[model samples]
Target: MERRLKISSGERLLDRALDEGIALEQECGGKLACASCRVVVLQGMHHLVAASEDEVDMLERAGASAPNARLACQVRGTGDIVIEIPDAELPPACAASSPVRVTPRAARHLAAQLNKHAGAVAVRLAVERSGCSGFSYRIDPAGAIGDGDAVFESHGVRIAVDAASLPYVQGTLLDLVREGLAHRLQIDNPNVRESCGCGKSFSARSS
Candidate 1:
């Protein structure tokens, strides 16, 4: 049976649903970390997947009060269902938003280049204060490691992040981009708020 998911205000319901063939809005490409893809299941709640610890934690952080609200990425169709879309969750600046994603090749290349220069490659990913929105990613060479940082390795590249930022970037994919004379790192973040026009800074939802 077909199921329906409703989007809330400022939410991109149809766009995201169509992108994944699930009839939901995923302005950030269905990244669970971003709340834009959130939905309110008006019916058939039993047919949806159970919420994970991560999802619950994020919802709490987002200050969502609706018991039925769920991230579309975390919900899979099981049977016929109904949902409602609200306008408050929709961002007025959706048109100007750019979602970032990372590629495996880029990660490997970055790791190799860093290793060549530093002998030991350390890529520190952190959220910094910048841009008009008040927050942006800060990628710099890690001169020393610190506590509360989670480390992950992919294709010889080491990724380090503090405990606080991990929840926001956990499922994120990283990639590099070159547009005209501009070369920059693109983050396929599901937890991003509207980024600055220059794409250097982002303001994520509270969750």
Candidate 2:
């Protein structure tokens, strides 16, 4: 479908779509964590904010190769733009099985950590393009749930993973490991094909 949207100085494209009753699948709640709301910008690319590294990563994960393809969830700025929403371009949803698993020990540790952080809702799990092996894992306490976050519970703690990161980290297990007197969390991802010798990152198998 074709639409011409004149956004305010800093209006998010996704919000405008919602206001106009347009159907855009924003599986990450406009968190820049998914590509479900991708649109091909036929005009006015210069008026929008430059895409961030995270958004680019998500687009790459979604296999969006077109130079003008932008995620509506992350497109916010001034001016008028013409965009095309391709019906068959939306990425598929995550698998039915839980993409990530947290062990009891890890859940206990995470739950305690969440208590320490102010207003922490769930533990956010994500993959960033970094380290020598192409990707690295990141875990942080999420203060609020995004609209498109894939939430799961293990033991008694909740975990949230953005839809974009779910594809690369599926079948992964989070656990706590103790070495000597120090304790650290570990990620056991079944999708890893190669690990950096420095133990800092890994390359995931194609989804």
Candidate 3:
């Protein structure tokens, strides 16, 4: 079925489709690393940039059926377009199964940071629009829990997650791990569908 999906100059096809509530399967998180997000362009091929060399390679490997077949992840929207997901399977409704988990390492790190910053009260978790993926995680010092906020104590530190941000980070594990000489908070989120090459942003859908 052809649907009118408005594609901005830089938005990806999958992201915009989701924005319009048209769910499409994208198991690889729109990383351009999987075939689950393939679609056949029904019109507006010229509106899209020609497939990248790597994209062409991936498509070739998948034995994609047509000249108009393209990876939704690699295709940036330049104008309104028509495309079809040939597979008949219905897209699943994505939702978080539970709140994020705080690992011992992460809780310890949060405690230490909270101690060091005497003015701080707790760690606030937020999800912001970022990266090639639609969102990125943000952590900050929250003096007091906001309305509809999920606040609790884990390990030795207080953690707060607003209702809106809670779902995106659901079933995630936050931990502090050593990456060389520096320490980093590792976000082990199951909902993450794809992350940008630089790791600055990621795209995720609910499960």
Candidate 4:
């Protein structure tokens, strides 16, 4: 089954959804920990299964609207559903523009942090074999610069991707978010398949 959801202004729902070819955001790969992929069910409420306690807890932290907001990771599609993106529920990292044409929110949040800290931090983007989707991201504060690495600067922060991983992450963006008491890094990648529920693994779709 398939579902359709609408994103508010400055949201990248369509881009991220099409890239993964799924109607869910498996942040933490889908671990149900980070609620970055939560969505509101504007229509077809009866089609979805009841929200589990864990999902409800996550939704509470996600600041989702009562009786409507649901985690995309948890709401398995039955036939089709219509969802509206809310700003209050919007992932913190979503923004309007990015240099790499990736998701803007994550990059914007990271940029804000860099500005506040005024410290040098390395952003390394890489893919690892793990998670429900068969792969996940490996993000770390870069320590050393390697030769022939592709680097892009956003909001005065330098993000580097290894030559090998560049293709997989091309046109991807990063964002930092604070949902309730939980804070996390979000990735909006154009090259990803279904991510595990744990947000630690993912699989790439075939060309």
Q: Least lDDT summed over 10 consecutive residues: which range in candidate 2?
A: 90-99
For residues 39-76, could you state the per-residue lDDT of candidate 3 as single tens digits?
Answer: 88888887888888668655543445477888888888
Clashes of 3: 6
* Model 1 lDDT tens row, 69-167: 877666664555576655475433222232122355557657665766664447877886678877888777675667888776644567777777765
lDDT by residue for model 4 (1-207), tens: 335654333334434355546545455876788887776676866666787866765664443435688776666545445775554645332222222332245556556654555344656677766656776677665765679677777545678778766666665656556789986776666567567767677676422
Task: Write down the RMSD of candidate 4 (Cα, Å).
Answer: 13.5
Model 4: CA > 4 A from native: 1-121, 205-207
- Could you give the candidate ranking by lDDT, starting with the highest? 2, 3, 1, 4
Model 4 TM-score is 0.44
Deviation in Å, model 1, residue 141 alpha carbon = 1.9
Better of 2 and 3 by lDDT: 2
- Candidates 1 and 2, the one with greater lDDT: 2
The most accurate candidate by lDDT is: 2
Candidate 3, after superposition: displacement of residue 205 in Å?
Answer: 1.3
TM-scores of the models, in the given order? 0.47, 0.53, 0.51, 0.44
Mind giving the per-residue lDDT tens digits that candidate 2 earns over 1-207? 989988898999988877888899988787776688998899999999998866765664565657899999888999999888887764333333435667667888999999999999999999989999999989999998898888877668888888878877775677788989988988877678899999889998746
Predict model 3's lDDT versus the native.
Answer: 0.74
- On TM-score, the candidate that comes out on top is 2
